[model samples]
Target: MRKLVYLVATTIDGFVSDAADSDPTGTVFDPVGAHAAPLMAEYPEMIPTHIRPMLGLTDTPPKHFDTVLEGRGSYEIGLAGGVTNAYRHLRHLVFSTTMTGVDDPAIELVNTDPAARIRELKAEDGLDIWLCGGGTLAGVLRDEIDELHLKVYPVVLGKGVPLFGIPTQDSRPGLDHFTLRSATPYDSGVSLMIYDRTR
Candidate 1:
């Protein structure tokens, strides 16, 4: 049984991306770049292969996960930027209904049931599963996630894709408590918080 970790970068106010709800990897914020070395050293496997060349990283050994699960919005950001398969290093699975026949053969699409698909993935033997991006899919598979690695930036985006979407009044089945395992702050004002699911 493998663990599912949602490793994401979010604003201090709990927003993941800029307004209009774009992908997290679309642009590298200047502030984030300051703390990039630490994050890259911590989670090298999460770095896209195409980016490693620029970062001067050789994919020798993965840090944590071997698989990555993403939502349509997260995957489409690459497509919108003319990149169909963003994470060439990991086993990428995208949850989408409207997308099909992407150019990449390594990319897998799950349109039927995201939760069910995640459950099946959890049973497989692997390093771990990285819930790379996707607020909606994250909300849907909230129960299956075993850990959370949040990179909290100092900036605040008042309006954007939320870390966890859905109105507070709406009842979500997987609203579980998490125990903070670690909180490390960087000079660039980016704080890395690791949380393990209480259940």
Candidate 2:
């Protein structure tokens, strides 16, 4: 069975994007820093297909994930840039109920329950699934996530999207479902932290 890995970049304050929810790359966060080399070398699959040639990773095989998942917002970010399918090299699934007319055969739109679909995907034989997210989708599939590979930057976005998209003041108490597996600090003040689900 393959694992569902929520691989994302976040700020020290635990925000994935700023208040406007814009693309963090090269704007709020620098992707070409010291951490770039190691990250690209290890998880080349995370790089969008269109960006591989410039980064000299055209032939580099994916090390961690074979499939990629995203929410409507995350998918639209690329669509807005005229990129219908960003991760063309991977099996891409976009969860959206209101989105329609996506003619890209390479991308599949999932309108059903996220957790149920993830459970079905986990039972298939393949590399781990990469949950390239927006917070709302993360909240829906929180319990189904098997691992979290976070690129923690040093910046602090005073307010923005939460890591899980769950309200901080929600009545439900937090659960310790994951344990820190490794933490790799880079000279650029960025850290690659990996956590594995223990429950």
Candidate 3:
């Protein structure tokens, strides 16, 4: 089966946005763009000195997998203004119930059973699926997620959007199997931690 990998960044307080939902709470972290470096340089006090080298401060456009999957809201965040193949380098799949279809050739929108469809993708020959954004889709398919690659920024957003909307009741999300995978400290006191789920 194909695997679903969630790669996202969140605040230390566990919120993705602010009360207004206008943008991320801190200036030190940028989840969607090439925002990490500049933010770090501006606020050296926020980031730990020891962690900088480990985090690959110079790295931008990092790739954890070859496939990208996202919910409509998540997709819109990067595409609302216009067309730009955010994940053009790889296969992109968008999950949306409101969208009748997608005109963007770069993305394939699914109005069908997303979880089941993901299962089919997992069965394919190779590559893991990158679950890109929004809590709703993640909540809906909580069972399908196999790993979470979170870039934990140090700031705290008392409230805003959460990373996962679903509450796992029947079983744990399986954090024990996670390999520290990778990590690096940012200049903003934030550390990017990538966790790989083991099945």
Candidate 4:
């Protein structure tokens, strides 16, 4: 069975993106500084197909994921930039109810239960599934996440989209636990933390 890895970049205050829902790595800060080389070298698959050539990773095989998952908001960011499918190199899946007529055969849309569908995907033979998120979907599939690979930036957004967009006060499912596996800090004040879900 494959694992579901939530690989995302977040601020020290635990916000994945700002309130405007713009790409944090683009508008808020650039990720091409000192941390770029090691990050891109370690996770080449995370680079978009169009960017691979520029980064000289055009022929590099994906080191981690063979499939990429994202919420409607995350998908729409690329769509808004005239890109219907951003991660065209991988099996792209978008979870959205209102989005219709995607037309891109390479991109799959899941309007139903996220966790259930994820369970099915985990059972199939493949590399790990990358949950390249936008908070809400992370909350929905929180229970199914097997690993968390967080790139913690030094900045602090006073308020924005949180790491987990779930409501905390409600009598929802209990919090899942994870064990920190590794933490690598870069000169750019960015740290990469890897945590494995505690079963």
Candidate 5:
């Protein structure tokens, strides 16, 4: 009865990374910050609009997950940016075969089959599991994912890492439920789409 939430940002074309497995041009825009300088002067809700409901911040997540899971690349990105520690919200579990050790004591490193461990995690008690992804991780765990919070942007990456990498015939995952939520316009003409996955 544990829930796995895949929360990510994808281009309008559904590519999570460029062809080289890197973020496309506008995946993370500064709308909430840039626009805030001028817009917030007129409307306070304009800033919160980009967050809160748009990012599923309203409901408190189920108290079944005390850890957050992210691919190695995502964790590296944070590390390179000087975040040597996990965020205040949750314990971090980073999956990386290449990473020998994690500098952050708060983060535990897992180098084996992530999908298998994720399934095993469901049996434990904590807050809901968050699948902070990169294309490689998503493709691998597509079957175990229970919910997908897709933040669709209005722009297109043209050619970047696809949201779902091509899987082998035996591993393709199918969606059982999908719901579209409110969309907010950001810089680069992208709108965020929140999708709840139930399979």
Candidate 6:
């Protein structure tokens, strides 16, 4: 089975966005511009095809996942600007309770148990599935996650949406066991940490 990887960026305070409750779509983490150099260089596949050349990474191929998953709020960040498909290179799947359909043909809208669908995706033959964003969805599918690919930045968001929407560690005590597989630190104080679920 393919791995369900929660590949996301987070601040030192463990918040994914700045004031997620108030402005979830706002770009809270400011260091992404400077941090993008090492990140895009190391993980070229993560670069979207639309702005690849603009970032001087046109030939970069997706190195990790062949499919990407996102929550409604995560996908809506681009939807407000008429961009339904942000990552056009990979297979995009968005989870939403209210969104029945979307304008983008490349993106699929699903309103059901995300964990069940994730399990089914793992059974298929392809690269691992990338849990793109949203702490709420991450909290819901916490158990189903096999690995975490975190881009840890130096900034701190005192109050915002957490890495996981809810407290996974507090809710399931002694269940959230993970070991750091590797940690690559960059000059910009951004670290690429890969942790595997070891339970």
Comparison by TM-score, 1 against 2, better one: 2
TM-score of each: 0.90, 0.95, 0.70, 0.95, 0.69, 0.88
Off by over 4 Å in 2: 166-173
Q: Which ten residues in a row have the lowest lDDT in candidate 2?
A: 165-174
Error of 4 at 67 (Å): 0.2
For candidate 2, the per-residue lDDT at 183 reads 99
Encode model 6's per-residue lDDT on 27-140: one tens digit a residue. 554445556676776666666667678887776677788899889888877777667688888899999899888778888888988889999999999988999788888988
Clashing pairs in 1: none
Taking every candidate in turn, the Cα RMSD to the unseen true structure, in Å, is: 2.2, 1.6, 7.9, 1.4, 6.8, 2.7
Q: Mind giving the per-residue lDDT tens digits that candidate 3 earns over 68-155? A: 7778776665555464445665677899999877756867889999888889888896667778676667777777888876668767
Q: Which stretches of candidate 3 lie over 4 Å from their true place?
A: 19-28, 31-63, 166-183
Over 4 Å off in model 6, which ranges? 21-27, 31-34, 167-174
**lDDT score of residue 38 within candidate 6:** 68
The alpha-carbon lDDT assigned to residue 77 of candidate 6 equals: 71
Q: For residues 1-199, could you state the per-residue lDDT of candidate 1 as single tens digits? A: 9899999988888878877766555352443455788888888887777777787776546779999888888887788878878788888888888887566889888889787888898898888999978677777778888999998887777777777754466647545899999999988888899999998
**Model 4 weakest 10-residue run by lDDT:** 166-175
* Candidate lDDT values, in order: 0.80, 0.88, 0.64, 0.88, 0.62, 0.80
1-199, model 4: which lDDT tens digit per residue?
A: 9999999999888889898888877655568678888999899999988778887888899999999999988988887888888788899999998987575888888999999999999999989999999887898788899999999888889888888884676625666889999999999888899999997
Query: Which pairs clash inside model 4?
Result: none
Task: Please state the error at residue 197 of candidate 5 in Å.
Answer: 3.8
lDDT of 2 by residue, 1-199 (tens): 8999999999999988877777778877798889999988889999999999999888888898999999988888897899989998999999988887475898888998888899999999999999989887887788888999999999988898777875756524668488999999999999999999998
